[model samples]
Target chain A: MASETKLSHTTALILHALDAGLVYGFSVMEMTGLPSGTVYPALRRLERDELICSQWERQSIADAEQRPARKYYKLTVAGRATLEASRRRYPLLERLIPTVEAKQV
Target chain B: MTARVDMVVRAFQRGFLSCISLLVPSGQRAEWRREWQAELWHVRRACAPAGAVSWQAEREVTAFCLGAFQDALCLRLHAPKNEPRIALLHGSALQCLLFLGGVLAASYGLTLLLPGVRVESHPERYQVRSGLIMIQDEAYSNDWVAATIPVERFRDWETTRQRYFDGLAFYRIGEQAVSAGSHGTGGWEVAEASKNLFSLLGLPVRFASQEGEADAGLPQAILSDAVWKREFGGDPRVVGSVLRVGGRDVRIAGVAAEGGWRLPGKADVWLLERDSEIAAGGRGHVVAHLTNQGRSEMWASYVHIDAYSPDEPGDNLCGFSFEERTRGPWGIYQFTVLLAFLALPAITTVSMGEYSVSSHRPSWSRRLCRWGYMGAKIALLLPIVYFLSLDVAYWHTTLYSLASEYAQLAASFSICLFGLRWALLDQRQRCPVCLRHVTNPARVGLASRTFLAWNGTELMCTAGHTLLHVPGLPTSWFSTQRWLYLDTSWEFLFTGSGVG
Candidate 1:
């Protein structure tokens, strides 16, 4: 149901950030330099579009550190396709976000 | 330390989370709150290297606050065709007051009618507690162990009580003319008791004190029937006659009922505790009732000069134990009833939560959730405790002045009771979507914004649906200014391009 071609620059940036290994919300915020307001909603929209999927990090990791569990995001096949297409659409994103081949999973 | 910064951020997050609770469906409330909190935690930690009291929380939380508003609005716009938007009944103010008020009114009515934890025979006994120290139940198990009432805590309460209670009789005792009346005169020993001490002791009033008379510049005293018989020859007119107490000639306002009287010291006369008695640290016995959790406070109000733990455990009963008839068999029954009220839905201490917090810190918003729960409980109790202290302060100040005081207490306590009960009982302790009773419940409140029970937690139903929502404090007040500034700018930038 998602209109992928209409993806906004913010959405593309978030997808690229996810592919580039800036997986969690704040990490994506750091990689993209977008505010929490922008980053969270964009993530929600991308997930809704089936371009990305998220799972909570292991509880042990959060326990090892003294903090809350982080939600980790990874590109779906569709998400990878979108990121590849976005790289062409937003040329600057290629430099900002990592390519999928650079990531192991 | 990070504590100071944590305080401010926690307060903002608490209020913001309370508002967010209103937007999500009830079934999903618990889950969403946790997820959002976790997200916020990560957001803050990511910037923790910035400083302990980083500006990041302000910037980050503000964005999150705005995001909640956007989510509420956008989620509504993007709601699936079959799913209805999350909607709380948009009742008129009167309607809100009517339903919520009715629930509150009933909760208090029940509390007032129900006798709190009590020993049927010894009504004046209290379970002593203090802010600085908590006397665990083990200490209460033995015979009465004495703890010197914390004068400092009482003094702090004395100084700060005016902030919550409006009554002058109790707090403004310093302003009263310390009665120049005789302190010790006739062989008449005097006892100081609360207004309901007689009724609490299962005795009836032989002569009733007039409402407001305690504040009317008239001295008030209650004579035991024996004392009345011996001193005034049982003359009915003695009720209005003045009896010398301390330096003041306190009027004989009433005579205690005669039959089955069993008070320690068997004082000939009873009167309201005076301001000076508080200063003097009156020695008294500890009264532990199975129901009242806040007993030490009663001791702190009076009993000024004694040391805490007046006797060794060998000589005293200190801890709380119902398994052995420490007080009496009836005390056990009373405790069971109290426990039932606290644990069962529609009883006392009702918590409405769907999911318990799964893990401790490093869980995003870990400290915030724990602190928020504590803050909520304090926020709920502060006003009740405030007015309660006022009643303690205003004891016998005026005839009939107690009705309003008690009504204030009942109202506040009822609100707490109503919140937990409504979430549990009226809602059937089930997830609205799944209609399963298998749910957890918790109560939450705004930080520093005590007296309002706006935030109720949500849990997922066994059906795994997160589609129900509960009514909450309308956040219009919280949103107004922010809406004008952040929202206006927010909408100005992104209104036409609303997201799915």
Candidate 2:
């Protein structure tokens, strides 16, 4: 039930981007070519659905970078399960990105 | 160069985001605006080169704006209010019901405040703008002067149907001025009316009987006995003498009837415009008889006629049958249209949303009172429109018409200024929470109510912090009905039915 897979291509792309360590909203946009308006609200809905969780990056890190602090998203356990199912269902998602060992936030 | 381009991009982004937010829901609109603009900045920064906009940059900007429209559309679709539900239906239904009740209550309220106003007394006679001659009686007059009869239209419509319709061409009472005396150039108001005005309004013009004193198509003014004395000190030489008025020198045609003809606007010192015929083929104000068989009404009306409450008899009703005067929907619709069109929906929304007191006074009490003031004046001045338009002798008899309306208008002007707060003012309850006087408390609907007393009053503090201090109930619906012991009257008691 937690991994109940109803993943669309757009959702799979977003999940794959999160797994690839492109966690920030702008970073996700860079990875998936999705607009910020779409990506931000989707992030909110995903968080609401408990498939993704987010936290603001450290202010000091942003100060050093001379930019606003970015909010970061990481897949929850349920989200990971869903992603696993989505990867199988949408095999091209994996082929489109570099393979990397996913780390838990 | 890069900085300049960045500045330009940021400015354009700011303008676009501001426009997009107009469609966003009120609750999340600000937050979404800031978030999207920030994201847009990032997209543009990433896509733009150091000095100029690239094709990729423009595409990114376009995509971002398009996405913004999508998000705004979603937000606007259903930003449901978080409110309570009870006996009747859901929260949305309750809100709609409350809104409708407020409007109805306001309409009912208007009757209470403005009792005794009659609709028929309002002069409603105006002509269509089909090449009619226009006369500026004055900005304050706002009266329809006359319509011109183009030769072509006259030949086509009137001359063709001359046997059936006796309606004449070029009806107008052009406003002209006269000297109060040589006391340092004082101006007196007068009308330069067409001769047809005299016949239409049942007025008679007295031409100078002396030989050669009549107008030979020159500017000719006639002094009434009143103006004859006041301006010329009753000098008989004033007759047929030159009286300079409206920057033109004109001979006094004759002294009008003692008090001046009973005309609308009580125009004395009239000049038969030598150019009155010029309006025949020229632009003219469209005017009909001020008193028609069915009576008359003024269109483009901000002036409300005196209305007696349905609870009372309106003797001044301009002869409308009682049913027409008191019909509910038409009157309210008229007011609703009036409020919506003039104030651009704010007044309508305010009137509909604010309904704290209903029973004895109903919510629209103050508006009714203001309408009463205006309507009473209209009733009082009912004869003015007819007399003036027809250049009749009635203005002499109703000498106080203009002054009476002016007095009422002054009162209404003050009332209109106060109507803003009075729209929200509920007479039954007083606001004591803020101790900020009677004006500080607002009526916030109860979160939940049963069918019982419907909507009761709550005194709320509105200065920064919200503190609802509710007074005890005066009465409930149960006070009236003899319920069978098992009747579902408890919904009236336990749940909020009328707490809007």
Best-matching candidate per DockQ:
2
lDDT of 2 by residue, B1-500 (tens): 36576567668767878898888877778766766665666667677746466656776776776777766766676555544324223323223335445544554444334312221122221112221112222332334222333323322333343321244333334455555445235556555545444333333345563542445645656666666666677766656666667777767766664532322344556655533333344333322232232133433322232323334443221111212222222242344333433553344233322222323222356456534433443332222222222222222232323343333333333333234324333321222211121223444444355343344333332221122234233234322211011123333452343432
- lDDT at A3, model 1: 30
For candidate 2, the iRMS in Å is 2.8
lDDT of 2 at B11: 80
- Show model 2 residue runs off by greater than 4 Å: A35-38, A100-105, B1-6, B49-59, B78-500
Candidate 1 root-mean-square deviation in Å = 23.7
> TM-score of chain B only, all predictions?
0.26, 0.29
Question: Residue A31 of model 2: what lDDT?
Answer: 76
Question: Each candidate: RMSD to true structure?
Answer: 23.7, 20.7
Instruction: Tell me the TM-score of model 2.
Output: 0.40
Docking class of 1: acceptable
| lDDT at position B71, candidate 2 | 69
lDDT of 1 by residue, B6-37 (tens): 78777887678668667765655675576678
